[model samples]
Target: MALPSPPLFIVFNASSGGADAEQASGRVGDLLTAAGRPHEIIRVRGDEELTRATVRASHAAREAHGAVVAAGGDGTLNAVAQVVWNADQVMGVLPQGTFNYFGRTHGMPTALDDSVAALLSAREQAVTVGLLGERVFLVNASVGLYPRLLEERESAKRRFGRRRVVALLSGLGTILRGGSVLTLELSVEGQTRVVRTRTLFVGNNELQLQEIGLRHAVDVEQGRLAAITLQPVSTLRTLWLLIRGALGRLDGAEGVDSFAFDQLVVRMRRRVRWVKVALDGEVLRMPPPLVFRTAPRPLRLLLPAAEAEEGSA
Candidate 1:
């Protein structure tokens, strides 16, 4: 028999998705109450507060195996998941962010009411998580052009406010601005090779890869990481890949190679002291020689049963 579900501890970012987070949290609380599910909602302002709140929730939920739900975008979910990953506490998502990639990948609804309902009637599964040093990410991690795109997106958001159009314009600007390629020395599968690429992407979720027709990996739950490298190519070629990705046919895109591995050591041939890398939409500057591995410990996540079945099928 399965263990009893505990009271939910929700970590909500009110300023997310360009809406009043307080109003959103209130609405979620109302929904949970109406559903007769015992839940406690905690509002956080930034990453630090989110970490503290999740820690509190994790302790509070220990008695009942309750889940900790992140009510925001991939960045918010990433922060919360890092705190609760591989722990007894389960992780859930409300997906109130602009891209909702993590939630959608798990077959969860993006709407507030539907998301809460799904969480209340969800099951726990051991999901794979990617590890970059000490940080845990539920989505994908990358180096190169992707991080530059994220920087552009943040600048755009600050200047023109957060909107889908802004994100698009930001991406366009990044692609047009062009990016420098990295000479990477990679050690994987007991063989070492050198790659000159503009971007190196590591994916932890197969649903995301399949959505974009990336075919980076066949299974995310297989305790392995899916990595893709976009060779140094012309800006137009990169743009063409984006266009193909938009149409869900990126597999055949030229200059793109995908592979699977359990762990890998990546180094910059030029030996920079630090490099910009993006994990689950959050960018960070880390020391060179980034070591990436997969944690098969399985992060327990909540998703709608119907959608889960559909996704499995």
Candidate 2:
């Protein structure tokens, strides 16, 4: 598998997770250099610079017939993907996050040397992505308690460290504390049903869905998204549900409902102007009614040799 014969424009964020971006970039540079692949590393300082940096990288990649690479977490990848997808350029990943869901899902190596090596021989593949309204999400999108969990997990990471245990503990804490219930009117496949729950999660990544023990994971490969909603329950039951999710036995768990859909329209039964939604682990306020669906066009992702071959096979 041969990638585009041009320099790879990599957008790296220094503050994403606890990884040393300098060391990581240095390793990537060395690997690419050894492979004789010309590349440029764009270091981003803050979230404010993400769009500008990605746009710049996209333009450079477009001009050179190269691919734009994201070397941070899923959020960074999401930002870069938005620009690369819009620019109609191939995108690559160097996973540098605590949970590199997107990268792992696509069989991208997490090690810098191996990932760069993989990128050097990667092939382009079009992969499905989710859309939260007009915004693109590669992993998952959610509203309600799930987003709150992400917020709390981030705060815990800042206070403690960016480790899987910290993230797990923080999420458990959020779940134990409990949150406001949402009254949602969910419309899917021409059927509308009113439900009350703490969160509504729409998953596009099959690996993530499988991790959480949802059979709906298969739906993603079939050109559909997996939707999960929690029934309003006591804090203890919520905790039990969380345990089930962690144990990969959440499929038939009580108080949890999982289904597959191509499109879903969610409306708040209560009046509210904006809804706090999490897209690929980034929280933002989006105006309702929230629409979750498969993007019209798939993202041109640069997959590793094995995955690319499997995708073709």
Candidate 3:
């Protein structure tokens, strides 16, 4: 017997990427309606409202096990996932962001209408999620240069507009500026190790590795995270590391270290109370020491039929 389709409630971020949220939401609604898919759209002006709206929407339509769709970028998706993770409801994505990493990682279409269609026909699957306290992240999380680069991107967006080119330039500038070195003590599998590096990156999504052309270099979905560190080095050497990491040659890259672990506790040597971290491309000031671990339960993600099969395989 064919299963009934669940109701969909979309939460749109007005300032996501560089697109007009209302027009995008309207397009999604029009397409879904024309295709006989019933849904409700809630357009939000700020990120703070996404969590509340998603939770409320999910509960209001609990009888249907309605799916809550994030109609924006990875950050917006992360916000929605925080409310829906481990719940009885499912989660969907409309990839309307600069990178659209999470959505694209799950085989979602870039075009708004196509993404909506994909969601309506998507298969449900269990996917791992990374958590820091109550917050949930679909991709990777990092401390150090990554957060600084995000901050730089925002500053550049305000100065040179929100074009991709400007964001690229801003990233280049950030890279050239270098970053602070962090001394981290990591505890994993009843063992402890200390290291110093320019950045600490923890990832749970293998799609990110593939996106960077490193599919063969790392696997992030094996019930563990691919933790990578870029050790402090000269500017030229750093660039080399970046290129090598992207090409799946990170194992031989100088000043780069990679490992896989189920749970990690990172403590800063300085014992700072708070640290700036970037999760799924969004920057936040979080208190330390940061506890990193994969949620034991997988998030129920909606993926296209083909993508679902591929993931299962």
Candidate 4:
């Protein structure tokens, strides 16, 4: 399970999840150096810098037949995956985020040393990703209240520091305060229906869905995506649903509806040119009707030897 012989291009985001970029880079560098594996550390800051860095790393990896490694949270991994997947180059991960859903789902280690060691003996596997229009989301994508929640969560993390408690409180605050409902025309599996809901969340990672007690995780593993929506409910009811989710009991919760689909087309009931959407963990405004489906091609992810073996078995 030796990795590609070319030098690894590591895209390290310093600000993500309060991680010390220098420390992470040093440790990763040391591991690779000790293995006599050639590598480069491309440190980046902010969304713009991350975009630029991934692109640069993708090109270098492609030319040298190396792999582009993402060393941050889900957002960083998403950014790096967008470039590396498009370029048809293999990608690796070093989970440094609060919830490394994508990494953990694929059995990528979280500790820097273990993750680096895993990568050194990793094998390539084709991984499914979601596509919102042409954009790629490795874990999940959503619109309506969910994206707004992410925005508030990011703000809270900035002010209160990045911790699970802070994130939980921020999400609770956002849900309690309430947000506008979306009137969406959803077309899935040859059926079109209009529904009013707080959010429309589509999940690609079984580990994430399973964490929330969603049965559709099995669907994702079977090469389909899972879509979830909340029926319009009072703020208190919403809070209850949140609690249910936290307890891993959301499977049959009231005011919640979920299903599996190969592709879904969504249009707002009201005429609107743009809608706020969250991909992975980053929020952006995208044009409607938003088309949610599996990427035409899968990402060639570098997985640890054990995980790779398990997948084959």
lDDT of 3 by residue, 159-271 (tens): 87767789777887888888779999988889989999988888777777665544422557566777888888999888777666557566646677777877888889896
Candidate 3 Cα misplacement greater than 4 A, ranges: 1-4, 16-19, 213-218, 246-248
Per-model lDDT:
0.83, 0.89, 0.80, 0.91
Better of 1 and 3 by lDDT: 1
Quickly count the clashes in candidate 4.
0
Model with the higher TM-score, candidate 1 or 2: 2
In candidate 4, stretches whose alpha carbon ends up further than 4 angstroms from where it belongs are: 1-4, 16-19
Comparing 2 with 4 on lDDT, the higher-scoring candidate is 4
Clash tally, candidates in order: 1, 0, 0, 0
**Stretch of 10 with least lDDT, candidate 3:** 210-219
TM-score computed on alpha carbons, candidate 4: 0.97
Model 3: clashing residue pairs?
Answer: none
- Report residue 302 deviation for candidate 1 (angstroms): 2.0
Query: On residues 119-226, what C-alpha lDDT tens digit does candidate 4 reach at each position?
Result: 988998888898999999999999999999999999999998888899989999999898898899999989999999999999999998998899999999877899
The C-alpha RMSD of each candidate to the native structure, in angstroms, is 2.5, 1.7, 2.2, 1.7
Which 10 consecutive residues of model 2 have the lowest summed lDDT? 14-23
Give the CA lDDT, 0 to 100, for residue 161 in model 1. Answer: 77
